[model samples]
Target chain A: MSAAGGSNPEYVIARVRARRSALFGDEEYRKLVRMGPAEIARFMEESEYEAEINALGSRYSGVDLIEYGLNHNMAKQFNDILDWADGRLYDLIARYLRKFDAWNVKTIIRGIYSETPRDEIETDLIRAGEFDDRLISRLLDAAEIEEVVELLSGTIFADGLEAAYDDYEDVGVLVPLENAVDRAFYEQLLDGLVVGEETKQYREFLEAEIDFRNARNALRIARSGADLDPTDYFIEGGTLFRAAELAALATNPDELVSKIRDSRYGDRLSNALSDLEEADSLIGFERALDAALLEYADTLGYVFPLSVTPIISYILAKEREVDNIRAIARGREAGLPPEEIEEELVIQ
Target chain B: MIEAIEPLMTALQSEAASGPAISPSAAAALAVGLAAFGAGYAERGIGSAAMGAIAEDEDLFVNGLILTVLPETLVILALVVVFLV
Candidate 1:
């Protein structure tokens, strides 16, 4: 649909709300955590993951079956939303779904670099983004990273990837290329958005995500004491930190935490800041950030029920569900205790 | 319709009177037409939303239908205005 047409928020919100109601609640997660891999797969079979489990049941078993089923279901659910959206709603949503495009491109590139088989790479792909099967197949068939860059020529990632390729060639590291793809995605998110009152909240939510991401990256770099410049990791458009400010802040852990505590997210993340100060653990802080973002999105949905916010809220919730289930299956496979595994989940 | 237009045409020809342009019954008709338009506009969003809900779950069809037509009350109230006039 053309951008000139009005958004069908009421319809989109209604459909998204129905799907949102189907997501696993806290009780389901509790039960799933206690179960073994086989039991968990069976549990999923009886729930929303039924069709996925039955469809993949013939070929795979155990955690691999559950993993593939979860990924496939996630891709299907997200693609269904994208298909249902129209006009401006489609534009707003496709902006976020393009994260999967970045994921697919990165997966294909890493697979090629590691000499992984095509089918192995294909299984990891989410396929929930804008890329059609033809383009993705072409990407998978490309032997060289340069070819992947070339194949993405007309796309948003093309310019960023092409420029980053020079750095990749120079340093023989995929970091620059990956950063380029991420930067391109984040930059395009807020670019040229025509902000109405409803979309201003959507824009703020996007900015909060960027801020959280930058805060996490800065904390990680600070904790590592890496010699690398933090500005290289600094994403644009967040209210939290400027690139130069982040570069300076990355050198000091206490100052960086305090900086985040002083920002607009200070109130929401106050507990997380104290936790970071006391435990010095980034994982818990990151999870807190995730919960805060989820809660923030939920508030936005409540504040503007028929706009783009609820759809985004569902998207985040669905992605968290998929991630939580994957964590459960993998944690169970690795023989971790249920409590520790539960600690890793970011349910809200 | 032709008979209704006859008085409006005569009024247009006699331009000296600076008063209400249309008769009270004509005004009431315009009000009901606008009220129906408002009802339709209100139902447009609700009907689409209800259809979307029903598409996801067939059991919601009855509920959707009920909500979709809830705005028809506007026209019904405006019909009361027609009678009172």
Candidate 2:
């Protein structure tokens, strides 16, 4: 996965395409929505997840088995991708996969803050990031949040965590530390990205992701009617809103909807925006956003067959599959109806 | 430099007047060599891709092998020049 040679996108894309075709489709989800957690796990055992299921079968059963299998399969798939990619492809893919690193860091911090068991925290990690196992094990061994921050020194999060540690000391809340991790991840996502002709669409897709994230955060703050500043949640590199504009728009829901209605994403997000206006619930609108982004990424893969977009599209789709199956399993375990569970899925 | 090249130019013109430097068969061989090089370059990408596919699925081994050699036809077609010469 090291960036040291010429990129071999051809080899990597071929394998990625083969794997993409094997992902679960709408039919699978429809069938899964009606099954119990055990049946769902059994169904997964007959497919690409067979190996993961068999390996973790003894350790977990029922919904927990399904959850752990999904995590393990996802981590394995993404790790294989990193192993196949070389040179610039490795760098580009690794850049995006760093989000897992951010997720793991936050999970570890939250686990320590809540005094959760080390084994439980360890099980929650998705080892698809660039960080090695030794580093992760060391992080897991740390007893305090301060030790976690100190262990993260020499990483991209080091500076941000260092700055945020002072605020954590003052307010004694984990919010500052968590926000610093998120900001660090998002900031480095687009940093120094060489936008060539091939990567132009990829860059645009990233911008859309950032824009949707900002919009979601703004709507969340608006709906909560909290007295916090929206600028604190504003992520740079999105074309939708500046920091001051986002702060101003966060106060008015109607104006914010109208603003999104007129932007470049308006055409794709029109249905979601309208739903947000009519319904008081944010779940439907958030699902719509996920579906739109999935569809957008699906189209991007076809436009450039040889670039990193296809791999990224497959990555997103796989993550969605994992999330969908998890939701289905969890929903069934909760005794929710099939129709309601289907509503929770984001199939394109 | 001009004075140095004058004798060389006169010698080259004499040799050209006598006969062409390379025979047609030799030229044909050169063409085939270039064609083979081109085919090799084309196969470089396809071979790696084919290997990747085969690595994912064992059934694709035959298909990958077939596709990897598809570019060899270029070199074979270039062999016709040798016969023509």
Candidate 3:
């Protein structure tokens, strides 16, 4: 159980595999999309989400109950992984789970800046990250945005927030602070990672995610024809596009599409790229990216069944399930037709 | 001092020549020991995975037990080398 001991990928992978199979398939999604919010809640209770649904059932009903249950279950599941992992596995996972830390921080900052109630903000905070209950409570208790930033002084966000705080004072917008937090998370993601063969593959997977994100941002900027510089949105460490290249490509959607099609991800993303060209919609392109990333992770898992890949694969699949369920619930609540809701899903 | 050391050296040499450092039976025992170690190493992963599966679902108990013991065949194969030796 000590950090010095070897990783227990075997045990984690077994549990992960079991959970992966429990995720909703196409049939479940079809049924869920056709069902009303109450029916969806009922359906969830009969499945893997039974406990969360039942626990939240009394307080809230319909979509709110479903959403809260999903968030709570997601946090619990991810936290359990961190609890079960030890040694380097824990370190690797904690690094990734820090995304939720960033999520919580941004939510609190926004809540304070907008004068949202503390209890209302609390419901939005996902407890999946390395941040313990004490830290989260402190953040929630902070009355001002500055106090929230000061509370994060010892964290990875400290330096980034310190720099961004100046920009916030000058511009009076939350964008700079949010970007700084994101940059901090992405920067720490691959920092000083000692690359073994499998870890190198993992690194590549992460880089691909960064690349796709950058590409999506570029595409959106190009589509919008905004006067804002694309370089501001450029995330470092992606191998696909340099900052200067992105600035140029962001003005030309065709060139951006061609560039992505010519890269190493071209084969896997060919269909998505073509869809982007034909459909000319950001949502479809984003869904395609999600599906492609999910497929890539699944392949990586099978290729190296005994490494962190399987766990990562499971994590991605679980996140997708949660997203799909959320989308279905929200879409149904909005009275969107089932066919349109199906389009919103990124199911494989 | 030289006279005392000379007799002790000869006695030690005579004792060394009386038997081999490691007998064949001892080597065979070493082989079984190493084989058992290999089996245990293999079982470590399978056993953990089986336990995880069993913990998830009660129906998997039998399956988990079977997979957990699959690595025992390595020790069994190593035992044949014991008989041959």
User: For this target, which candidate reaches the highest DockQ against the unseen true structure?
Assistant: 2
Per-residue CA lDDT of model 3 for A174-209, tens digit only, reads 999998898888778877776776677778888888
Docking class of 3: medium
Model 3: fraction of native contacts: 0.69
DockQ of 3: 0.62
Evaluate candidate 1 and give its CAPRI docking class based on DockQ. Answer: medium
Models ranked on lDDT: 2, 1, 3
Candidate 1: tens digits of C-alpha lDDT, residues A1-348: 125444377777888899999999999999989999999999999988999999999989999999999999999998998888888888999999999999999999899989999999999999999999999999999999999999999988999999999999999989999999999898888888879888889999999989988998898998988788999888998888899999888998899988888888999989989999999878889889999898877787887787788899999999999999999999999999999998888877
Per-candidate TM-score against the hidden true structure: 0.93, 0.95, 0.91
Tell me what TM-score chain B of candidate 2 gets against the true chain B: 0.82
TM-score for candidate 1, please give it.
0.93
Clashes of each: 0, 0, 0
Worst 10 residues of 2 chain B by lDDT: B41-50
Residue-wise C-alpha lDDT for candidate 2, range A83-200, written one tens digit per residue: 9888788878887889999999999999999999999999999999888899999999999999999999999899999999999999999999999998888888889998887888
How do the candidates rank by TM-score, highest first?
2, 1, 3
Model 1 chain A worst lDDT window (10 residues): A1-10
The second chain of candidate 1 has a TM-score of 0.76
Least lDDT summed over 10 consecutive residues: which range in candidate 2 chain A? A1-10
